[model samples]
Target: MLRVKVAKEIREKEQLGDELKTLRSKVKELEKSLSGLKDEHARLAENEEKFRTLIENSTDLKYRCDLKGRISYLSKAWEDALGYKSTEMIGSKFSDFQSPESIKFDADEFLKELIDKKISSYEAAYISKSGNIIHLRFNVMLYRSHTGSERGIMGTAYDITGLKCIEDQLKQSQKMEAVGRLAGGIAHDFNNLLTAIIGYSEMLMMNNLLPENAFQSADEINKAAHRAAALTQQLLAYSRKQVSRPRAFNLNKLVNNLDMLLRRVIGENIEFFTVLEIDVGLVIADPGQIEHVIMNLAANARDSMPNGGALTFETRNVNLDEEDCEKYPEVTPGPYVRLTVKDTGHGMDKETARHIMDPIFSIMDPIFSIKEGGRRTGLGLATAYGIVKQNNGQLRVTSEVHQGTAIEIYLPRAEEKIEKKETPQRKLETEGGNETVLVVEDESAVRIMVGTLLKGFGYSVIEAKDGNEALEFCRQNKEMMIHLLITDIIMPDVSGFDLVKRVIKTHPGTKVLYISGYSEEEISNKGTLGKKVPFLKKPFTPTVLARKVRGVLDRD
Candidate 1:
């Protein structure tokens, strides 16, 4: 019995040892599992903090919305972007922040599509706290629940207002460029026709043998033709195709010269003020074009203030540095002369101001003006805009509704001293010269008229119908002392430039004078005129022709 008890005790001890070892192994496994759970929790906490930092620090507007389109969470960027705090926007519907025209797609429909498509992007305009519209491009993704059902949307919005403005400006510029090309072509043809009409009319007026009544009729025709010529010049100006005869001149002086004329145009009701800067720098630009700019602006100001108001013209010298270049991208960093025109009349709103430079968008487009007995072509401002730009200058306008309008033009300063031009009171001599001259023109009327005029002016005249005839004449009369050659720039058989080149070889001492109805740009190159050759514009009176011929012939 003693042996049995001892054996039983040993067996129980062995079983207890096995059970204890098993429990110890299980405890070790549990410890390893606990350690892994703690590490995983710590990793998840770190990931959450990183995501929060990214959302909070992002420049773009980040937001979360429920499937119902209600805002649940919004980043602090909402305050910076729309002037609305996150707290103020948390419970608001997304549509509440959008303009009526900007809600292109329904919120519910957008969410449905987002859920069905998994992700989407689009553009919309949001209304800011100040009531200004903000353009935004959105990038969004639909968030899903654990059960694979749609939970909400996570999205970011980027501001695109500046880019939108630039795009609008580019589109408008392209439209104007197309119109300019068309206008230039039409003006070239019209100018040729006007030259013949005006020249012949003047000839009739000069003929003393004509009836007394004929003088008045011819004068009327000439006056009307002059007005038409002015219109053509305006077209050329707007198209940027006008040949600029740039010279150094004082802008303040130009303004001062126009003082009497500007006052008369503005009428008795309006008050005029001039603010000229002492020692204002001279600007390099076409004097005629600059005068037109001032006149156009003055006329516009007059129309704006029909009920009577103050019109101010001011000038000053300014130096634009790199900072100015950034502020005014159309201007360079250099010395500039600024001319400002300000009026205390009705001002334009943003929408109207945007299209102020468009030729057809005038207040006169409706066949009437907002004021009594007012009519305008709306091309005045546009011509000024083109002239300023072509001269490497900048024109800027600002206006507010019922407040007033202001226009600023900045032109580059010139290095040379300026000499103001004045018309001489002495009458130009119209006496005929005895020098032998050759006239070439494609138009029969123009050719005959010019030949008759020169003959009347006492010059022995020879006429040619075209370039071929002119070239043949020059070759045949190689020994003839052709004192001067006056020819039209464009001809059928040969260009005037080529004809001149060949003729000069035979008659080396013959002085050449080019006549043209074409704009300087049209006849500048492409086998047209030589750089140093003297030119006479068509539609000129007999007096102008005689003086030009004498001037060229007398040149040493």
Candidate 2:
């Protein structure tokens, strides 16, 4: 019995040892699995850190909005592009930052489509903390939870505000260019017609053969034509096509001289003052046009303050460089004189200020004056803009609702001495020239008027209806010693400049005189009329025509 018990105990001990060894092996396996898990956790943590760093530094705005349109996440770019704090914006809906119009048009329409489509791209406009518009291009998709259920909207946005600004500026420039072209075309035709009316009336008055009543009637026609001519000139001025008589003059002197006139313009209800820089540099612009600009600003200031306000004119000399060029791209980098016209009156909002300098905007705007007679012609700030532009200057306006308006006019400083122009007194019985003159005109009335006036001045005269006809006349009368070739600047067949080029090749002795209703860039390129070549402007009286013909013949 004792031997049997010992054998059984040994067998049991052997089984216990096997079980313990198996348990130890299982423990080893578990320890290896735990080590693998720890490695995976460390890798995952590293990946999360990288992702967070990328999202924080990315220029593209990253946002996640829940199904209820409440924002859950916002990237750091949101704060960079817009003047808003990321923490402040994280709980808010996109509509909170959007402009009212953008909310009404963009979010309402685009968000509806996005909801239906699940994945889409769109553009949205948001107002910045500083009240500037921020345009964004969003690429969004509906994200899902682990269970594949729709979770929230996640998107990336690119700031497109700069592109939007460039687009708007391009559109405004195109619009202004079209308007300028239309105004210039109208003035060109109107000036030609006025030349005929004024010329024929003067011829009738010059005859001295008509009755006293007939002469008075002719005088009335001449006066009416002159008034009409003035209207055309205003149109030209607005289009930057007017014949400018520019002179170098101190802007401060001009402001001082117009102090009383400006005060009268603003009336007693308004206080007038000038902060003149005593050493303001000289600017080369038409003095009359500059005067008109001053009075127009005063008038506009007066109109803005129907009851009472203050009108102030400030002048200063500024030296512009690359830094200023960035701000005023239209201005050249050089010395300039700045004229600031400020009015403490009801000011314009951004919308109104944007279109304030557009031609004829005053006719549509309610803030402009309708008085000052029809002579004002509803140009308002537009006239000043054109005058400034034609004189190689820029006009900038800044205004806020109820904050008053400030208009800054920047004109380049002139280095050359101002040449005083001799204002020739009108002589009804001017001297005649015996030299031959060729008159070319597309309009029969102007042609006939010119020919008659020249013939009566005791000069040999030949006329053509167009450039082609004049070219033919030059071809036929090669050895005629044509003496002078007077032609219109623009025609359908050949231009006046081209005609002169061809005529001068054959008739080298022929002097050339160009006539046009309005000045052109081409005129400036060739040295303005009466510079390199003698030029006669249209709408001249018989005496004026006679004097011009004599001057050309006498100049040798």
Candidate 3:
């Protein structure tokens, strides 16, 4: 019995040993799992800290809000940018900081899109604590709680006000450039028509056989034609087409001559003052255009102050070096004539000044819209701008609302004296000798008038409707001596240049005189007309026509 009991006790001890071994294995596995969980928890904590650091320091105004638009949390950037403490902003409604004008009724529509389509971004204006408007681009997403319950909205707000201003300025500039081009083209065509009417009317008035009434009628026609001509000249000046025969002329002389006129134009209310600097040499510019520029600027100043103010015209010589040129791209490193027109009148703000030079702004009269009884068109300044640019000059303006405005016009000085040649006196001779001249013009009335004038001038003038017709005439007259080819530059079918080439080939010694009202730039762009080719801009007086023809004939 003792032996049996010893064996049973040994078996029981073995069972106990097995149970202890199992417990030891279980403890080791639990310890391994516990160590792994600690490592994971440490990594998670590091990642959370990294995320927090990134959000806190970002320039973007990161924030979280509940579905009711109440701010739940905001990054440090939000508080710093908005001048709000974290405690003040945390429970406040996001809409509280928005202006009534800035409230988005579209938010409901956007919310529906957010929930249904997951649309994530929107833009709107926000009002700051200081009442300044701030444009914000909000990149937002719908947030949910861990249990998938709708939590709130989170977003990053980016400031876009500077970018918006740049875009607006770019658009305004593009619009102005487009309008200027259109104005130029219309002016070019109108000037051509004016030339013909004025030229013929002057010829009629010179006739001695006409009765008193006829002479009176002719005089009336002349006056009316002159008025029309002057109008077109202004348009051309604005379009940058008026011939800029720039010469070094004394600015003081120009201003002095117009002193009386300026006073009269501005009226008795505004006092006109001149601060002329002595020995201010001549600026290289078309004097008439300069006069117009002064007039336009003066008019603008006069209109600015209905109650009247002081208008000062100052002149001086400026030497612009390389550094000055860098600041003004339009200015070169050379001598310039500086004319400043300053007025003690209502000034303009930055937004108005930015668009002041635009033709449309001038056309619409937006600048003068706020005045009690202002009479003005924005065209005066725009026209001045066109004139300055055409003269290869620079214009600068400075102004503040209610403080007044100042305009500076800088015209480059002529490097050397431009020699002036007197118009030669015409020698009188009997009309109608046998000189065969080919007349090529596109306009029927102009062609007829020119033919009649040529016949009266004693040339055996042959008429052709266009350049092609003129070429055909030249071909037919190849065997005959064609003394002159007077052709219009712009025409249907063959251009004036093409006709000139064919005529030169057919009649090697044919003298070609090109006529057009188009500007030199326009003609040159069409084809090469060397300086030697005599060109008479259209609407020429009969005397001009006769003289040019005689000059070309004498040269041949």
TM-score of each: 0.82, 0.80, 0.70
How accurate locally is residue 250 in candidate 2, as Cα lDDT from 0 to 100? Answer: 83
Scored by lDDT, the top model is: 1
Candidate 1 runs further than 4 Å off: 1-54, 63-73, 84-103, 106-121, 124-127, 140-155, 275-280, 316-330, 367-374, 415-428, 443-445, 460-465, 472-481, 491-493, 506-508, 527-531
Per-residue error at 491 for model 2, in Å?
2.0
Candidate 1 per-residue lDDT, tens place, 283-322, comes to 9999899999888888888888878999999999999898
RMSD of 1: 4.4
- Candidate 2 lDDT score at position 261: 79
Candidate 2, residues 196-284, lDDT tens digits: the string is 99999998998867999999999999999998877776667777877788888888888999888788778999999889997677898
Question: How much is the lDDT of residue 33 in candidate 2?
Answer: 86
Rank by TM-score, highest first.
1, 2, 3
Give the candidates in order of lDDT, highest first: 1, 2, 3
Model 3 alpha-carbon drift over 4 Å, by segment: 1-105, 114-162, 240-261, 274-288, 314-340, 346-361, 364-378, 391-404, 408-434
Local accuracy by lDDT, each model:
0.82, 0.81, 0.78
Candidate with top TM-score is 1
In candidate 3, the residue pairs with backbone N, CA or C atoms under 3 Å apart (3 or more residues apart, or in different chains) clash, namely: 195-539, 362-378, 432-458
lDDT of 1 at 375: 57
